[model samples]
Target: MPIGPQPHGRRGTVEEPYTPLNLRLVLAAFGLVVCVGLSILLFRMGWTVPGWLLAGWAVVALVDIVVIQFRRRARARAEGGDHSLFE
Candidate 1:
């Protein structure tokens, strides 16, 4: 099928095989980097000895798990496998 702009003021997007998985992965990685950097800065400045780095790592890990699950479900649904994406 032709993947192009939709009519009206609606956002343009493909129906399938072109979900935002790649974009989500990129954003998640960027968030992880920012979290670690901020944490280090705060620690070095003596403003707080909080677990900034650790917190950032945790956020990245959590998001990774969620993204993986979402992609898996999408694939399963598209393939008409013996599983429901909503389930």
Candidate 2:
């Protein structure tokens, strides 16, 4: 009774917004590029350990990009047409 807004107390019904897969793909791609570039720079600077770690992360980003691509293709097919990624 002392609050301006009352909590729903676990009975609140909230709908989650749809995730943007295209944006995820783009971000993953950007991450991969940055990780790879930084890894190379670190290696040239003789920071072997961090360089290897960044390289590993770059591989993970690459895999994520591939997985996102597959998901995008499946979603497009399920939607009955091949829509552009930006759409």
Candidate 3:
């Protein structure tokens, strides 16, 4: 049996709320810190390959943080509010 309401010719659409950007930014920042720290530890322990891999992931996390900051700033500007890093 079909669950819930059918498509019904696409007359009605449901919209889902999105995760807040600040939360995403915080998570990305945390990931970057952890990756960098672990990669450094791995390098000190002579695990070069894994260290490099973690370093690469750290870079990705840094990039995500930058993008999220930009988006957050834009959103704040659109909403006519002053946006700060700690906000």
Residue 82 alpha-carbon offset, candidate 1, angstroms: 23
When summed lDDT is taken over every stretch of 10 residues in candidate 3, the lowest stretch is 1-10
Tens digit of per-residue lDDT, candidate 1, span 1-87: 332222333334555344344455566667777777777777788756465655667587667857655765565565544532222
Where model 3 places Cα greater than 4 Å from the true spot, the runs are: 1-17, 82-87
Tens digits of per-residue lDDT for model 2, 40-85: 9999999999999999999999998877777676666656454445
1-87, model 3: which lDDT tens digit per residue? 211222323433355333366778888999999999999999999999999999999999999887777766666555656544444
**lDDT for 10 (candidate 2):** 29
In angstroms, give how far residue 30 of model 2 lies from its true place.
0.5
**Structural similarity to truth (TM-score) of each candidate:** 0.44, 0.73, 0.73
Q: Give the C-alpha lDDT of model 1.
A: 0.56
lDDT, candidates in the order shown: 0.56, 0.73, 0.73
Clashing pairs in model 1, backbone N/Cα/C closer than 3 A? none
